[model samples]
Target: MAFKEFNCPSCGALLKLEYRFTETVICPFCQQSSHWTGENFEAKGEKVILADYGSKFSVGLQASFWGTKLGERKEYKFKVLGRVRFEYNDGFWDEWLLRVEGYEQNEYWLQEDEGEFFLFKKFDNLPSVNEYSELEVGMYVDWEDYKMFISEKAKAQISGGEGELPFRVIPGEQCDFVDGILLKEAIPVSIEYLPDNKKAFYVTIFNLDINDFVFTEKKQENVY
Candidate 1:
């Protein structure tokens, strides 16, 4: 049988109409439960709770990082572009899709949970210097292999601890960027400073339970 396509009237989320005989389908994008009868479909506007699906990060959320190391500590910044849920032997894993504005043209995914952050294993290509040069403040930079870039302003804040940093300097607090994206609050559990205060900054990922986390949806104005 031929398949059909439908758009959500409430959120405009794409819905795939899979069968001529099938009369009902759930939207994979938005959690809104919908029913299809004949040529026209009705949006119930009821929230459907999935067994495994939960909160998800939107595309416009700004990616921010904190450094515990001293002396030109790298601070990699990026924006979330997509998110996917994966089920494995252990449990469910939420993979955040990121796009590095100036470093890489393609998208990368990162596992969002406690413990160690998992790298995107889908891509074979790496970021380049040319891409870095194109980066602007508030642009999304995935935390892949590229280390965080500590701005001179941030360095001054760390040295003196007197002035406020451009981004959130505190352990937790949602920070705003020029692009209108909001970043989640995170604290560095550990930091390793480099010698001469100008080389490297190693930081341990924040340990937090996934159940306690909340996801922010993408604003309608930001959708393209």
Candidate 2:
């Protein structure tokens, strides 16, 4: 079986175009319609290609420690939740510790250039952590209440509003901490295969405006 990539116009979800007879497929994330163009389907749009995991990191299974103080520096302690092999640079590499947090767990599609990552999710009723257990990788997630985390310094930089800034203003999103922007579209995905023979999970997302999406690696901390 072969799979082609297709992006959802409403929710920006990445879908695998498999069934040619399936003219319309609803996006799992946003519940949006992804209609197929009968004629010149190949020219309709472009497909997104992902990268392979390399040999840089080792994969294992363990628990992770997360800490968060409303107005202070956040800290993270990853305790090997599980191990998974990531295909990178044509070869496979193992990631020993995978951190799982509400916000940090969202899944994102990475581009070949490693420059951007796309966040994909539906805006319907999002699931709780317990509910998240049933989700699989490459599946749709609801992004309605997802929040973004930023550092104190980042927040201060925005408040001062005195010097030149590097990031653009995101609409309808709140600024938390000192240096972070919050969005409600973050969703988690299940991670397959670990050293302990257990399963781990992470979050992924898709970008709407930008051609590419990138996730800023943040310290994993407990939300509440």
Candidate 3:
């Protein structure tokens, strides 16, 4: 985690990109969204600022967690690097990017929905389906020795974002999503089919409780 700094195209504010593969940067001063075009940054209009609901997680916060995943106990000390907010019919959820200490390339996604939290690792080997339309709810999918039952499906939009993200975030960009669960282990899996055939899958590694987290950073007023 090294970072590169850039000048905001809209307000001339400085933007530091913490994520190596960041494709978009939102100016903290002006809330202007800019897309990196390889050559330079281009304006994508002002993005909506996400409201803080006091969910106990925010960018730049340091925290630790002790949990067991897949029958192995582990402790993680990490920092909240960024967050992407998605809005669906049920409301919204925040996907926080965490940089885990003591590990190389150890970034993980922590999803917060309602009061439930799940830790996930990105799966590089995507499912065979090229399009979301090809899949339906209640279908059983067998992949990598696990039988997963499709539990939920929805179309969601990128409502807002904070800090740095690996990919471009276009506000109101919609994508089709599918959620599955390993029945025996109760492991949750998520799939997203985005525009331009880009897809991503996240395999849930841990089910977390609120008490599992210990804030390592001291709280400061107006930080969130």
Top candidate on TM-score is 3
Over 15-103, each residue of candidate 2 has an lDDT whose tens digit, in order, gives 66432233434444553433355541221112212232332212222222223335443333332222222332333323232333344
Q: Which structure is stronger by lDDT: 1 or 3?
A: 3
lDDT string for model 1 (7-72, tens) is 765578765542233333444566444555456656553543334333344435665443233544
Runs in model 2 deviating more than 4 A are 1-56, 59-71, 86-96, 99-142, 146-224
Clashes of each: 9, 53, 0
- The stretch of ten residues in a row with the least summed lDDT in candidate 3 is 123-132
Measured against the true structure, the TM-scores of the candidates, in listed sequence, are: 0.32, 0.21, 0.89
Model 2 lDDT, residue 117, Cα: 26
Query: All models: lDDT?
Result: 0.36, 0.30, 0.79
Stretches of model 3 off by over 4 angstroms after superposition: 104-107, 125-130, 218-224
Q: Tell how far residue 83 is off in model 2, in angstroms.
A: 2.2
Residue 218, model 3, lDDT: 55
- The residue pairs in collision within model 3 are none
- Which candidate's lDDT is highest? 3
Candidate 2, lDDT over the whole model: 0.30
